[model samples]
Target: MGELVERVDERDRVLGVVDRAEAERRRWMHRIATTICRDPIGRILVLRRAEQHARFPGHYDVMVGGAVNVGESYEDAAARELAEELGADVPVRFMFKFLCLDGVGPVWFGVHEAVISQPLVPDASEIAWNAWLTELELREVVDRWPFVPGGREALRRYLVSGNEPARPRSAERSPRPAAMPPG
Candidate 1:
């Protein structure tokens, strides 16, 4: 059986549940939880997706997270994804949530962060490798390396808002620089 996920609307209200494939095919909004694993000194963990993965194969991803499963809360999914992708179970603090629109579709992403000093065991099937990069180092590669669009968006949002929620605000936001090409 295919994985089941909740279909949601722009406001994050669940419209219904459907197979993951179907949800993707129809371009429905869905829930996703992404986590930023930070080191004690403040560098963020990044993962490279396996080369054979269906989406964003071989691209660098800022967070270790995935679709929120049926009946699962975003926090639970974030923790589950952290363990499944990197074999770490450190406590995560909720940062903020945002709606992302990329080539694939729309997905609401919950951003969380955790500080860990433990070694990570990457799941070979899900992540090819992992590294901890400082914000400056990440910026150097942001445009040079191929990253999951949603991941880039989330990262940009996080950076712009200074770790706060990136929701639209009455205050005008400064225009952002163009992103590096997707490798």
Candidate 2:
């Protein structure tokens, strides 16, 4: 038995509990809670998945999150994932929820955001590289990087919502390594 997740319908109504792997294998809808972390100065945190990650290996992601466990609210799952992945325990503001029908599978993605004030302790098993980038820098990277499909969609919707904070003129752009092809 692996991690258990609630199998849901298109309307996000819980049908029953299933192991996370079973849900994925059966193409059942499940909930994934994701959080976009930004610095106090508004730089978004981006991460490259480690090569050994079960899904989207060697891909880039703008959010850190995972499958929501059975009986967990989206908000609680978002906070838990942020802490598990980045070692940050900040308050997360729920942004929105949408059905993501990407190659990863159909999932109700609950998007959240937090301003992280503490240093990150990324789990090496999950994250190969991480950096804080201005929105402009992130945009450039997205154009060339093979990002995780669902996260890419989430970012697209988030950007369209115009909820992102304004970037200061003095915010420096960090140089990113060349993008690697997704494995």
Looking at model 2, residue 111 earns an lDDT score of 97
Pick the lDDT winner.
2
Q: How many clashes show up per model?
A: 1, 0
Per-residue lDDT tens digits of candidate 2, residues 53-87? Answer: 99998889998999998899999999999988888
lDDT of each: 0.80, 0.87
Against the hidden reference, what TM-scores do the models get?
Answer: 0.86, 0.92
Off by over 4 Å in 1: 164-183
Q: CA lDDT of 70 in candidate 1?
A: 89
